[model samples]
Target chain A: MSLDQQPIVSRNPSPAAPPAPGADAVLVARDLSVWYGSTQALRGVSIAIPRNRITALIGPSGCGKSTLLRCFNRMNDLIPGFRMEGQLGFDGDPVAGPEVDPVTLRRRVGMVFQKPNPFPKTVYHNVAWGARINGYTGDLDELVERSLRRAALWDEVKDKLNRSGLDLSGGQQQRLCIARTLAVEPEVILMDEPCSALDPISTARVEDLMEDLKAEYTIVIVTHNMQQARRVSDMTACLMLDEARGNGHRPGVLAEFSPTDVLFTTPKDPRTEAYITGRIG
Target chain B: MSRASDALYRPRRGLRRALGAGFAGLCLAATLSGVVVLVVLLGAVLVKALALPPNPPWFAVGEQLRELAAFLSRIASSTNSPNPELAGFKAGIIGSLWLLLLVALIAIPVGVGAGLYLEEYAPAGRLRRAIQTNIANLAGVPSIVYGILGLVVFSRAFGFQALALGKMLWAGALTLSLLVLPIVVIATQEALRAVPPSLRQAALALGATRWQVIRDHVLPSALPGILTGTILALSRAIGETAPLLMVGAANSILFPPSGPSDYYTALPVEIYNFATLPREEFRSVAAGGILILLGILLSMNAVAIFLRTPTGQRAASRAIAQLGRLGWSGRRAGRSRTGLASAVVVPGPGASGPDSEVAQPTDQGGAES
Candidate 1:
């Protein structure tokens, strides 16, 4: 039970390890580390997110899964005193570069937060706002309809398009958020525990929607639920807390990255095996 | 033994009830004391004003209203006169109304803008913190101090000497505006701060520029609160006398102010002049002026409360909703006109048809697993 008696497990893989040869990665993070003030959250974590697939980051609480997901779209930049070391690139261009405007970057890389956050506007406006701000001059009605249908929420909300987005049910609101993100036509969509706030039925619907959405846009999801990772993700990256390192509260680092089946059935790292088996988190 | 112990532990209900009743009585007395003083003061003023009666029913509400209307008309039409009975507040009313208009025109926009910048866009550092603290302190500063400041700044420093704006209506208006600006800014800032952070985050995440987010989301939600605060600030400015006095508001004028640069006297100033004179008739006139001032302030407050109500908000949203529908319909008509060209240009990316390509991978992944 003592702290020193715990095993010093090295979850970090060699830097020379290349991504799967034929995989088309839309995002490539190299030695990514994040710190909030002096407290580190992610430590040299690296992963190549494949295109047209759901890459789910699964781990326990305080495992930097959400932090790593936010790093893809640079959401962490919103936080004060947030420092990032290492490179995150989208389509071979550095995300944190001075030339890369976060506004434009975010447009191309949309995000869905953990909670369902819809602007206090109508459903139609919620979807249209993103496109409008991005200077989309096309038929907004058509676009909003298309996005809602793609999110599997068109039938429920088409009649009440003028109704406030906040008036919808929680599940509908989340789908509205998804539709809003889709309206902008982002190349990649990042979701941070998108279904954590929903009921089982809503979560299942979102999972089904995600499965359908993977063809045109890449998705990177952070989930605390192990079954969700197994059910929806094509590839699973398990991150774990490295308590023995740094000032007793060291940041989380990736323990295993493999196909979902491989990670579930035969994890390369013992820590990942322990986590997936529910022995220790 | 249990019963004995229970009796020992139980509270003295009678004594406790007595103490509660005593405290309640004290609070009731405290509230009534204020009401009592107000009623006594108003009664005395009314008795003095109505010293002479014309009919049998001297205190009828309708009769009093008629008399008040006649008295106000006399005051409105009469010019300044040496006779105490004929002296009126026509110049005061006009000056006050003009001052109110100018103060609102200048203060609301400036104060609200400062509030928005401070609350939304200002960098959270020492400079912003210092400015915030200074604004809060300024709101608490004495009105007379602001008067002196206005006298030096707007009246003397900036006012062209030949134009004589230093002792004009505009100068008094400027002083009152400055006196209330800090209050308006502080209230507006509080209102803006009450807006949910999630709304901002949602807008920003949708790729909105900061200004767009504020204009499109934040401002609409904070509108009611902002209006209420501005109204309250304006009301305070309307009733202010000390600042105007310091800025040299005239005690008497022959005619109403013709322009911003003309000499002016306000309701409070007129009342002060009349009340200070050694004449009973002038004191009654001053009481009448006080009644009118109270009516104006009360009406302004009522308007503020009404606007802050849910019904007012619903009306506003309804108007916005109508506009939205109009725009939507107009766009629909335009699309119909350009149907062929639009069809070719639309469906650029992430459209439903292209989704078929994305759907395949998900199907394959499910099959493979």
Candidate 2:
């Protein structure tokens, strides 16, 4: 309830630093704890996000994986009663400081929601709108085309750019959301369960798109599927709910942070192994 | 056959069917009861307003139509009089129209602005909650109470002669506006709330300012609903007599008020005066006034209903999008304006010119928007 009385999280026996110790970290969180009106959501979630790499956060439901993803863009600020303590740095700058506007931060770090939420407008407008609102002085048509192409949705939607974005299939709509985010030219793309609503084929397309995207932009994705974490992510962070307090303070804490292959093949913590092996959540 | 299957097949289908039919019949009766009463009231008003002679109209339908046309023309041109033959609601009609326009101008923006502020901008606090609760309570307060408030506040200006509006058209208009303000505010709030939070989040995530998110996404999406709700509130205000009476509207006027400060009379006030007369012929005149008032109210409701439909909502949203594009593109180069307009202006199917190259991709195996 009080800042000084915030719950301390149990850390891994091994060092909590990610496997990529020397890699250029774009986002770094240290001793970060979050609360929503006295109900703690995340506790001491410390991790360094390497630049231009696909980092996936995988955990069971209500484990604060989404909350952690949202914190990168300051999206949790939208929620009422949301409060946080400790340091969250983006490019060596304190993100929650007064000098940094959340609007500016969001422009640099874009997000795609769990459900595909396309604007109720034409496909062309949906992509061009972000650029237009950000006061893009270049050719809007070119930007829209390039963003759609990068999302791998240009060829399918080129003939019908004038159609409503809602007219697209669930998969295409998700891709359209991606293209919309891309048009803003964000350095980091945060995806919260992007493929959970899509079929296998659409999910495969998105995974491939993610693989293509990591060569340029840093991506932080939160997914429930461990296989998705294995298939696309270069690095993975596994989180588990800390219910041991037994006082209704169920906060999520990081269990392991390692390279994707290493984390999946030989998890350091027993909880991570339990989660991956489907023994317990 | 299995024993369970035999038992299921032999269950009491007759009793179940009878019970379902009985329940459905009860629901139908409940619905028709209200409809039947409304139909009877409308029939009575129609007969009296037409002044049809008993048992003589069935064979003379053409003659009756000609007389009806004459009656309508007479009412359209003439002013109220003591004699039923010369009586009409032309002054009332014109005055009510002016009052409606004034109320719309005064109430709509203020009410809707308050609603938007309360729903979107206002912080969650005790003051905001108190304001919200007061507005909700104001909507349920009696019309006559509003009338008394209007009498003291708008007409008399609390004994300040210099500030008094003096029972003028503006005073009555202001009174009606105050009376309907709560309705409009509540309706606007409901409309704003109906817009999905996801749309706002989508816009906000794009680094749009709060105002930009509301202007570009939320407002346009809520326009149809707001329009319908506002129009319905306006209709309710138009039929209100008690408030206008307290505000000192004239029961009889030779001509409609030509300016805001001039004396005015509304349809409901004139009808009430006519209906209270001892003469039998004046009742017919009152019925005619009633018919005219009903016609106005019905048309307003029809517009509201139209705006409520999917087709109407889509058309409204498209027009808003077009307006938005024009404003947004006007600031940019004029060359791109035409290109953007061409893309947005033309509907998807069977179009030529720049949009022709863009084929319609209709069969996407998705839900219809």
Candidate 3:
């Protein structure tokens, strides 16, 4: 039987080859596959995230967009039974290896979770904890203020910096989380549906903040909202479930990777077209 | 309406409502049964402690009140005597307090540390589950079982002279510590588990190491819950007599323990000794001793409840207020006859459950779609 005709053991080429080197790619994944125990979640997938640009990973639920984002910072290490195969890179350096310290890797590639997960601590402490623990020797007060300002949060929270972060509005708490990530001075920011918990106004504000932030930091966001992927991203990667195998298990595969405008406006893979046109996910 | 809609909204309405109300009534009755038993016991203890007249106290309320006050003062101040009028639990009280201090010093650090390791560091698998199950089962093992274990392992050191601790005060303290260690561990685990996983994830994603995550976010959030659980466990320890007996607590002693090595007798052990005596006088003295022990236990448990209160200001002031109320009401009106007993029994089961005190919103809006 042909390779494609095999039930579940067959391998296929990635939907797209990884972007060539010197595309100014800061984070790159090649033929990356992930498994949680016996079940595969991500199939062979390749993509490149350019430096100083917003790269959005968009797909339906169960498509491993968040899984890919977490792999960049190795946050997937926290999940028991999570296993990844294939190369993941940060700043052109290998990241998905045992020799690398995840704590250090996470410092350089910080993340914001799907929900607004502010510490139940003072606003200032929430922003400062990362820097303090990462041993930032600079003035913490100045760093906190600068980070909050960068996240468009300083003015709203300056008066109550000592108040519990949990007291803030959901949008404000998300911004505080962004501010916290920024405080660690990471070069790459991984966001897993960062604005999904916020209202439209907050979403628009966060979108603007992302537009503003890309000049200084590379960003990779996993969003279920196709409109959001179109609105804020420079490069977009679409992931989708591969064909269901004989046993009915389907794993996520990269469907398309290109400039956001082209991917959204023009034709590409039939699956991408179907997803963009709302016929399939 | 469609048949489906009718089934969803109205089918079995009468029976369901009746069952719900019946269940609620059953729970109320179940709860009240415990409180009623506790109240009756407290009432009996109060009558015995005051040695109240059977039927003539209606007109001599003032005289009876004075006598009650005098009895309380005498019990609080005097040492144990074979003479009923002079008998008191001064040595027992002092010794129990010493045992409490030592037990807290030993148990808190060890139990909390073990809990932290199990919850945070231990790999989740068969071994962790085995240890967890064993610790849980240990919490249910009887106090006398622990007393026997203490006698063999801590006091006698299994007949090894170099390790033998003998029947020293520290031995008893160690025994009680073992008796309550599982409680402390279970409570600490529950407290640590109460801290939301999101907090840990947030900290970890910020590049904080595991230790940093726990130290910076997890520990602080879990502290109040841990304190509440530990205090309740200690209260349980304070009222234990069987373990102390097994570990060789003195039935009678002249002076309170001066140090960990000194021979000691606890309030419960002393009360048991007096209660078993043939004289009616010793029984009343035992009753007073029971009152004193209950007061301490209830106050500790009250503090535990106050700590569970989410607001810090209310926690501090309410704990102080409750402690004061317990002392004053127990002394003056004997009002603890109902209120204190019920408070003591209800919170034991309630507070030991998951840290329900902090109501974290569970909905993860849009939840990673």
Candidate 4:
């Protein structure tokens, strides 16, 4: 079977390729299609996100990478007219099943958005808000401190925990958002262009934090910056809009998914190769 | 060539400058006309209040202050005098206070709840749009119309009389609350809408339930705007006589309202009654009542402004700090160094007071798109 045809074989590794040794699948998508009303944003995209590793979705604008990331946590459900049809499994459980509450799914799979969106609250409350609502009866102060420490923001914010979260610089605010997500103790963190709004220094800090974070939490990041994918991600999935489909409202499709080194060095699809080499986006 | 170019530009520039100045002068005159009319009317009212035909000495500033003190004492004593000159607005004040309390109790929760439902939970459809349009229309409906509705629904249909709530303070309050409900809801919806979608998304991504997000983040951020709206609505409610009249607020009442289900007359209604009398002495009484009404309205507005202004919050915190210092000094005189150390170590509720009150609104205001 060719690489393009293997996606149709459900519940099996691609016959044209095989899973890398010891890379466990934490999240697996099979022919996932998403639509916002009549507009199909993603079509028949399939990829498995490995546990304890970073998976980067790299694509040009209008490629539905962010939409796919949002689908993992059912964030897309918040948008009116958003519809999805496909198999999406997290740890072998159906994510879109009626029995699986989006709220509960979101608790297990936190997301960091493109822009830094800290609550108009104190730095302390920003981190503690998630835990408090989740009925965490433990020491919230300690949890806040630990989360901030994990996000590498403790030392800078320790003196002024009562200050508003928005008082922080854009970079610090993004880290504060990360701390907020981390405080929930999610198994997976889906970041949609987390570093897109940051300066290089802050981006480096976040990238480094992601590297440290991957030992415990599976991460899926959608990035426009290909160099970021190469530097931070363990595995990379390249998606592209299918221009021939849907009469100019074409849906995004997964073109390539491989280990970061393999995909960057030897991308099987010409589109992926073109995208990586700056020939086309 | 430069002189010729300068000559060409100068006349046009001068003309533009003159036009700007003329416009500015026109605006100034327009503003001053309102201010001048207000001042003249206020002066007339003051003169009438302080110097009625027979008893100019009684309404003298010093005598008026003494009378005010006596009136306050009379209110504290809960006595009702029938004499028009000495018939202090004790009953009206009490009745208005009762009405204010009831209106707040009824309007705020219902209005805010409606606002939340409309803004957050209501789907974008014809029903929601229709409801929004109706709310806007309701806000524009005259106060007297609300009173008529209140009379029909609350007094006649509900038979509040049969239920022992006849022509009472609560009935008037209900009417006034209904009159202002749309205004409050509209204001609250606008305030809630002003909250950034990003904040809501942030909370949701953290796995917060919708209510949890609203209560913890959105409400706190929107509170200043909501409060400003509520106070403005209440101020309008306080001055409304036509609605209260329809709802059966007594033109004249002998006794102060002791409870919700008692015969009542608000300050505006009392002022209106006093103003219409054939006697000039009654005019002084009416002027006095108007002054009192203006004072209440102005003070409510002042409170709203204080809450809305960032600098006002800083000033309030400074005052609080001064009070704290006074307490600290008193403690220092009574106790030793250990007490001071304990004071420094113990984080009071006030520690987070200023920022929580001040920061959210300022940040939200700045961040609002």
Best model per DockQ? 2
Alpha-carbon deviation at B188 in model 1, angstroms = 2.0
Prediction 3 global C-alpha lDDT: 0.81
| Rank ordering of all candidates by DockQ, starting from the highest | 2, 3, 4, 1
Q: Which scores better on TM-score, 1 or 4? A: 1
lDDT of 4: 0.80
Off by over 4 Å in 4: A1-10, A14-20, A244-247, B1-11, B53-84, B158-161, B311-369
Candidate 2 vs 4: which has more lDDT: 2
Query: lDDT value for candidate 1?
Result: 0.80
What digit string (tens of lDDT, one per residue) describes model 4 on residues A154-231? 989875676778899999999999999999999999999999899999999999999999999999999999899999
**What is the C-alpha lDDT profile of model 2 across A94-142, one tens digit per residue?**
7786667988888889999999999988788899888888988876767
Assess the local accuracy of residue B74 in candidate 2 as a C-alpha lDDT between 0 and 100: 78
List model 3 lDDT by residue over B1-369, tens digit each.
477666656577789999999999999999999999999999898788777333336368887667766777787678778888888888899999999999999999999999999999999999999999999999999999999999999888999988988879989999999888998999999989999989998898888889988876787778788888899989988999999998989988878788998988999999999999898888888998898898899899878877877675345433543453344333323211232122222244444322211111111111211
Off by over 4 Å in 1: A1-22, A244-248, B1-52, B55-59, B76-79, B158-164, B316-369
Whole-model lDDT, candidate 2? 0.84
What DockQ does model 2 achieve?
Answer: 0.43
Task: Kindly list the per-residue Cα lDDT of model 2 for residues B13-131, writing each as its tens digit.
Answer: 89999999999999999999999998999889767767734334646888766765677667757898878889888888889998999999999998999899999999999999999
Q: What TM-score do all the candidates reach, one by one? A: 0.86, 0.91, 0.86, 0.84
Which candidate model has the greater TM-score, 1 or 2?
2
After superposition, candidate 2 runs with Cα above 4 Å error: A1-14, A19-22, B1-20, B52-56, B335-369
RMSD of each: 9.4, 5.8, 12.2, 7.9
Check candidate 3 and list the clashing pairs: none
Task: Give the per-residue lDDT digits (tens) of candidate 4, residues B1-369.
Answer: 367567655467788999999999999999999999989988887777666434436437787666654544443333234455465577787888888889999999999999999998898999999999999999999888998888887767565556545587877988899989999999899989888899889898888898888876687667777888999999999999998888788877778889887888898888888778777777777777777788889999998898679765445444543453344334324222232222222245666544442223223333342
Show pairs that collide, candidate 4.
none
